[model samples]
Structures are given as structure tokens and as C-alpha cells.
Target: MLKRCGRRYIVGAIRTYAKDIRFGPEARGLLLKGVDIMANAVSATLGPRGRNVLIEQLMISPRITKDGITVANNVQLEDRRCNMGAQLLRQTTSNTNNEVGDGTTTATILAKGMASQGLEVIRQGQVNVHALREGMLEASRVVCEELQSMSQIVETIGEVEAVATIALNGDKRLSDMIGDAILKLGEGGVFLLKESKCLNDELKVQEGVTLPEGFVSPLFANQGNGNRVEYSNVLLLATLANIERLDEILPALELAKSKEQPLLIIANDISADVVKALVMNQLRNCLRVCAVKAPSHGSEQRDQMQDLALAMGANLLENATGLSAIEAEDLGVVSEVIVDSSSTHLLHPRIHNEDQVHARVQHIRALMEEAITDEEVDKLNERMGRLFGYLATIYVGGANELEVSEKKDRLNDALHAVHGAISDGIVPGGGTAYLRCIPALESLAPSETPEHQIGRDIVRNSLRLPCYTIARNAGVNPDEVIRQVLEGSGNFGYDAAAGQFCDLKERGIVDPTGALRSAMSEAAGIASLLATTEVLITEERIRPKVPRNQVTKDLAGLIGM
Candidate 1:
């Protein structure tokens, strides 16, 4: 199947095949090699104080950032192994981002570490694949629990401040501003700022209170133009009136008049007679009037109403019946009436004071808190849980801050697969699910098993490429770094039977430096778990190619072609 594809295609097919197969050591090694290639590229930019860089290649130039998502999306790689490895790293990053809205780098490193150590156990014949997987699962659980337990409470203003502080540590002012905005808005209203606009100084508050330009009507106008009317001693209505009932309208108006309030009937619609009666009553009692329309009916109308309400006021009443009249009565005002057509009956509005407003705020806050808490608990209890998925990470430590920063961007691109998985909840065992599959690989290995040997070789060889790259950059011999990595694992590269490095390619051996080791570990784990997983690969339908005519004198000037 691979041979007919030609050399480049075959290599590509093999690269994909290695990621898709889940048996023995050779497959594991290939997978690991891919992972390491990607991880090492990112490890350099892991710290909080990391800076940014500019990456200029022949075809593209990207202003590099330490942000995991940014980096993961930008880096370029040609080798099939590198590409696959990078993909796994990306998946881990995505997983982290989706789950926590942060922590892609952390997950990437964790997966890398598990894969690296799991392979060693396989080589040592101390544990089978199943045991290794169990260990990984246990480790993941421990890690996730630790994270969740760390400052889970975000109740007080101080706690919220602390969250903003950590999230925007580099720019204390930005954090301070967010904290301040939250404080100013109190608990009821959310402080919504686009991520990009968070730091912009031109932001304006346009909702809630706006000073009247002149002698403006107390009634807040609905978006529609024709549905205008006036009121005095305004009974503010907050509901959709979609029903047709003289019975409903009459009672609500009577209640308003009992309070001596002039009703500003805000509703979806009112009968012509109902409107004329309200106008007549206002003139008879010397009452002023104002009326605003409610949103239309149906899903779109509901959505618009919600949006309008949210933008205009912090508190909203769900039932829009006779509440307007009730509120006017409380305020010791004259008749105020409100009507809603959708309701079975009309309701009197209740005027809310500062105390009522504060209560409403607290209610909203409690609701949000309850929701978050419930979600957190549910996530913890799931079979996969928050911690069981990809926790692989790559930590890049470097003396040159800029170089390290640049590598972070590259590494993130490589880990896109993991990142995405974390964002969108994963299927039990899918692509990038290998982070939880290390134990399965270990189980397949045995004492003196060729599979085990292949896994080790793959891991070791994978690390060599990055080690050499780093060594060369640092003005050291690539071979020296490669040897150091092997020695650190209690292994020697000088095997007479393998004929040194001459037959490494033939024997499926490669350099196993730290980067390669980590990458391979992650890739192998992902492959083991997700290899049999099938995806509904959607092929974009090809559009008919349009032929371009050669530019004539007339066209050349117009197009500047």
C-alpha cells in the first residue's frame, strides 16, 4: 500500500501509519520520535517571565508570542515525524485551553514526562503496558486534584482580584483594571471585555444610566419606532405582552390607578381600545403617560429582548404582567399601568429601591456561583475526569531568553492536537487519547521483547535530533549531548552488535535526547490509545477551476496585474 505512493508519499504514509498502529516497540518508537521532535521545540519558553520573538522564514514571518495557542498555530515543520509529533503537542495544548481556559503548556509537559518514564519501565521489564497505563491514570488523577484544590474558591472580591492578578501578572495595570471594573460593577452585572479590548483605553460604559438630553420621557424606548406612547408617574414594565385580553389589561390599569400612578404600559403589543382607554383615563385623572413596546414573539424575539434587557439594566423581571402598577403603588405614585400580551393575565410592576436592587444582585451572584460549582463537581466525577486526559507538557529552559521564547512558539504549534482535545471534551479513546494509553503499550512489552527494544530505540533516537540542535546552537558537539542523554538514562550508545551509528537508520535507531525522549513518549501514548479510532474525515468538495484569461492592454491597467 505504501510502495505505490512514491518516496515522499510513502514516507508520509509511513509517518501516518506509525501514529495509527498500536502494537509492539517499533510502533511506539516511531510515535515517540514524533512527540520528542515537537516537545523539544517548545520546552525553552515555559516560565512566567518568558518574552516574545520574531520568526522570519523564507515564505512567512510571524511575530512570536509566548502564548501557547499562538505558538502552536504558527510553527512550520517538513519532516513527517516532526509534523505528527507537533500535531500531538498541539492536541494537548488545545485540550488544556478548552478545559481550563488556560494551562496548555502544563498539560503538554505532563504528557511528555509520562511517556518518557513509561517507556523506561517497558525497557526495564518491571511493568507491562497495563500497569504503566494504570500508573499514568493515577498520576493524572493526582495532578488534576492538586490543580482543582488549589484556590478553588473565587468568592470574595479579593479572590477575584487574585485570579486577575495571576492571569495578567505581566501587566499589573491590566489586572488592576479588570479587578476595579468588577468591583465597580458589583456582583450582579458581569464586566464583559473582549480579550483584545481588555487593555484598550477607549472603552466606554453605555448602559444602565444615561443623562436625559432634555425633558425626556421616563419611558425607555424599545428598538421599534412606531410603538411609541407617553406616561407620567411611570410604571416601568419588563415583560413581553403577546396576549389579547381586555380582562387582563383592565385589572392591571385599575391596580395602577389605585396607587394614583400613571402607567407607562411597556409590552409586546396592546389592543387599540386598551391604548385609547389608558389615554382617556390619564386625561381624566390629569395623569401623565409613556409607553414602550416589548420585544416580538419567537426565538429571535426572545434573544433580542434578552440582549436589550441585559444591555439596559442589571435586573429583569421574567413575568411582565401587572408588575408596573404594583411598583408604582409601592413608590406612593399615581396610577401606572403595564401590559403583556403573551401572559395569561396582566401584572402590576413592583418599584425596586436600593435594597431590592442589592438583593437582586446577590441573587444573580449566587446563581452564577452555584452553576460554576456544579459544573466543577460534575467534571471531577466524570470517568475521564479533569485529570485523566492529556497532561503532557514540555518545559524549555534556556539561558538565552529570546531563543527560549522563540522555541515556545514552535513547540506550541507542535502540540496543537492535545490543546484542541482539552478544549472540546474528548471521546473516551480518540486521537490524542494516547496520553492515557501508555500502560497499554507497556503491557505489550516483555522481558527481551523486540517491541520493548523498539520502543526504547525510538525514544532514544528521537531525543538525539533536538539534543544535537541545542548542542550545535550552544557551540557544543551534537554527539556529546546525545551521549549525555543516553548516559543519564544509564545506557551506552557504543554497542558493537549494532555497529555504532552506521546502521542506526536500518536498525530503526535514532538519537534519544531529552526533547526527543519527551516527544516520543507523548506520541507513543497517543498512538497506543487512538490508533484504532476512526474519524469522519470530511473531504471538501472540489470547486470547478476557473480559467484566467491573459491580461490584455485594457485589463492590465485595471488590475495592475
Candidate 2:
């Protein structure tokens, strides 16, 4: 029996702990085993013909789906060590999703295969882990270049629609809608998800939707006036909602009236006095400015408002800057605004692109390349996202909640797939993109050089896993697909649906190279990290709180207690 005293481990008549408790080989073996177990668990859910995994829950009904990322996420392990290994492997998959927004399955399979092969080679005692990583790094670089070279442009609407169709399992309706939305928005569009209130069971695409920052007080509620209100030619303000400044907005309100346009006062705040003044103006037929607090607050709120100013060609009222902040040119044109007690909706039907938006994108990219830190890079990415200028919302309509839920998932997948294609072009999907990378890596096989040989073996095997798993999952023999694909010259491979050789591109099966690049980078990163992991350390589970009287006093002999 083992006992612990004050964070120390004791085996016999000792009250101490060993510092270097290394289960080096065992730990590594478990890493490989754990990752392999997870990969195999999801590998069966890889292709079009891949079967659904029935994940049963305690008391609840089981879930059935062929989504690889979903399967990986729901993976469970009874053993503690295996669970830890699975968790570490999961980081790669998670990163793939967050970064590239697709290819979680391929990433998982690659990471596990790399870990397994490298572990086996090192276990033979002929080579070190560094050699494996060096080869993998080179192999990964070549693979990336090959993928980029193989990519076909997503220029036409139909081609882009192919990407979404394949990702959505040939749902042409959703795919077409997504494709058209991307084309209409011109690549800088964000996705806004919402439920539909229409009679028909369908998905509707709205050009743009503004996120309301916060709601106004109930006193300003248009109660019984329905929830939607339309405002035009709004005076957009960025100052705090101060009642004392009620008179400050009079000039802009009057200017809009003279121009024969409705006044839309988008302010940071609407003090009680200002609200009353606007209401009185409406009653007296002077001018009715639909007052709404700007959608967001603080630094983020300010930035968003500023972006709106840029998009709408409106001027932001900066009281801190000067009194001149409320110029006539600063007023913006908003298509409509839906005001309510809970929130406000600002809609811009037309997506007007400023020439500076394109310039800003290029500038942001250059700054990103020169960034010195992770923080800087992230900030630049955020800025780039803002420059996109608009977010397109897909209002999904369903007869019930479950149908809506299912449609939302499919729509999301289609959107991400379409987004990735637009961002980085695309490569042949159904595992062919990953499959094609093997020959490039195979060239590095060093027969006589054991150190390099270990690395080569790890990469070559790992490089094939995605294709292999995909084929195997589709009920086709992996060995046959590998031979056929290797025999062909161009980008052609086994058709998962027919279980025969065909052009994947012709079949409308392809994946985003951006997503592929992200998946590969993450896969390589996780494999390299696992290769260098010398030990797995876990703290012992703490016991329940001890009673003070029952506790072993440290100064027992001195105090005779």
C-alpha cells in the first residue's frame, strides 16, 4: 500500500517522494496508443459512405452522425492515461476547427499516425525524436507546396457552390444559397444566424445585420407599436447619453427635416430629457428622430461604431475631439432600424464597398507579416475581419426546433466550407489532397541513414493515413485506392461513393486549401510536441477534507500532542 504525507509519496517505512518519476517509454507507448485509439474511433466516420457513430448517453437517447469532428469531440476514455493522451491529441483537432474551420477529421488521423509511427521508430532505439521532427517539418513544407500547386481556383459561382454542396453531403439547396450569398457579399461578409418567422420551411439570406449593443430602458419602449421601426438619414453619435446635451442634436435633426429625410439619431445614450424632446417634436410635427443607443459600448463598442461610420460614410460624433464632431457630413444613411425594449436592429440592404477597404486589407496583411508577437498577429486578424465591412445573416426556418437545429449545423458547415474556398482556393476533396502529399514525402526515405530513415518512415506512413482512413471508412480497400491513385499522373483518386477511380474535381468533391494548410500545421505541431514529451505527470487526487483533531501534527514529538 502507498501513502502520502504533505504532498510526498511513501511506499514503505518512508515519508518522502521521488522527484524524477519518469515512465518514459510507457508514457510514450501510451501516447501512441491513446492517439491511435482516438483516430480509429473517428476514422470510420470519414467519407460519404462512412457510417454514423451511435453515441449513447446515460438516460438520454443516443446520437447518430458521421461528422468526424463531432465524433472526436464526443470521444470518451475509461482509462486515465488514455484520456490524457486523447485530450492532448484533441488540441490539434480543436485548433484545426478554430483556425481553418474544417478538416478536423484529416488532422486527427494525421496526428495519430505521425505519433504512432515516430513512437515505433524511436522505440527500436535506432534514432532520436529530433530526426523524426526534422523530416516531418521538411515533409510538411513540401506537402503544403504540393497542395497549393494542386489547388483549383474558386472563381465561378458554380465551382464555389460545389464546395458547399460536397461539404453539406450534396444538399444543393443550402449549398446554392451559401454560394450565392458569398458571391453577393464578395468575401468580406460575416454570417449572422437567426430563426425565421416565415410560413414556409426554408432558409432566407439577409444581406447584412447589425448587432445591437444593448437595450434601452422600458420607458422608451414602443410598446404595442410592433417591434420593428425604420429610421433613415440618422445622425450617428458616439458620445455618452447625457440629458444636458439634448440641445446639441437639434441642428442635425433640423437639417435632416430640411432635406426631406427622416432623422435617425444613433447615440451612445438618450437621456430622459432628450427622449422627451424627440417625442414632443414627433407630436408637434417638427421632426421625429427615431432615437436608438448605439449597438455596443466601451472600446469594442467605440470601434464598432467607428466601423459603422466608415461603412455608412457617416461621421462619428466625438465630443472629446471637438464640438465640430457633429458636422452635417457626419450624418449617415441607414436603410432601417428595429427598436425595442430588449434590443435594436440596424439593417443596411446595400453593401457599398469603399475603395479604402481593399487598400486597408492589403495594408493589414503586410502589418500581419511584420508582426513580432502573437498578440500583434491576433490584433491584426481582428482588424482584418472588421475591414470585411459586413456580416450576412441566414435566417433558417423550420417547422420545429429539432429541424431548425439540424439545418443550422448543416448551414454552418456549408458556410465555413464556402468561406475557406473563397479565402484560399481549394484542393480535391475525399482525402485525395492528403493522399497526393505522400509521394512528395516518400522521396525523403533514407535507407542507409537510420536517423533520417526513422523520420521518413513516420512521415510517409502518417501522410497516407488520411486517404487510407477515408477509403477504409467508405468500405473500399485502402491498399487498392493507394495503388490506383499512385499510378495516376494528375489529381485523380478513388471515388468514395462508387468505390472506383475517378476525377474528384469532376465529381464535385474538393476541400479548402486554407483549411488543409491549417490542419497540416496543427497536425505537425501536435506530433512534434508529443515526440518531445518525455513524461506525463499528473497530481494525485486530493482526499476529502481532514478533521483538525485527526490530522497528524508536524511537531508531534516537540509538543507531545
Best by the TM-score measure = 2
Residue 160 in candidate 2, Cα distance off native in Å: 1.7
Per-residue CA lDDT of model 2 for 1-561, tens digit only, reads: 234463353342242232323477888876677787888887776766766676755445555656667678877675556677787788888788766667777888888878777776667775667766777766777788888988878878887888888767666787877766777777765565667886343434443334444334333334356444545444443444343466677667667777777666666666777777777776576764566677655875676666656665565666634333456666666676556655555566234357755775677668756676646654555455455645455778876654565566566666777878987899988777877777777665455656656665666677677778778877768888877887875658777777778887877778899888887878887887788777876543333333366344444433333
Off by over 4 Å in 2: 1-22, 54-64, 194-201, 208-238, 257-261, 296-303, 318-325, 334-390, 395-410, 442-448, 541-561
**Lowest lDDT block of 10, candidate 1:** 383-392
Clashing pairs in 2: 213-295, 241-269, 315-330, 429-510
Task: Give residue 83's lDDT in candidate 2 (0 to 100).
Answer: 71
Q: Write the per-residue lDDT of candidate 1 for residues 1-561, one digit (tens) a residue.
A: 465657888676555544333344554455566656655555444432334435554434435565655566555465443355567667776554443434444345555654655555464654445544443443333323322222122344443433333233233444344445445544322322221212233223222221111112322232135233333444443456542555665555665556665544445665666556555655565444444455346753443443333322323344435433334222222122222222111122223244543453454434443444434422222211101111111234444544455544333332322222222322111011122233333344343544444444333233234334333433445575455444432122221222232322222221112122233334445533422222222122233333466545446544332
| Residue 351, model 1: Cα distance from true site in angstroms | 8.5
Instruction: Identify the leading candidate in terms of lDDT.
Output: 2
Residue 142 error, candidate 2, Å: 1.1
Stretches of candidate 1 off by over 4 Å are 1-45, 53-65, 73-88, 116-127, 145-162, 185-189, 194-250, 262-264, 269-288, 295-297, 303-561
For all candidates, the clash counts are 102, 4
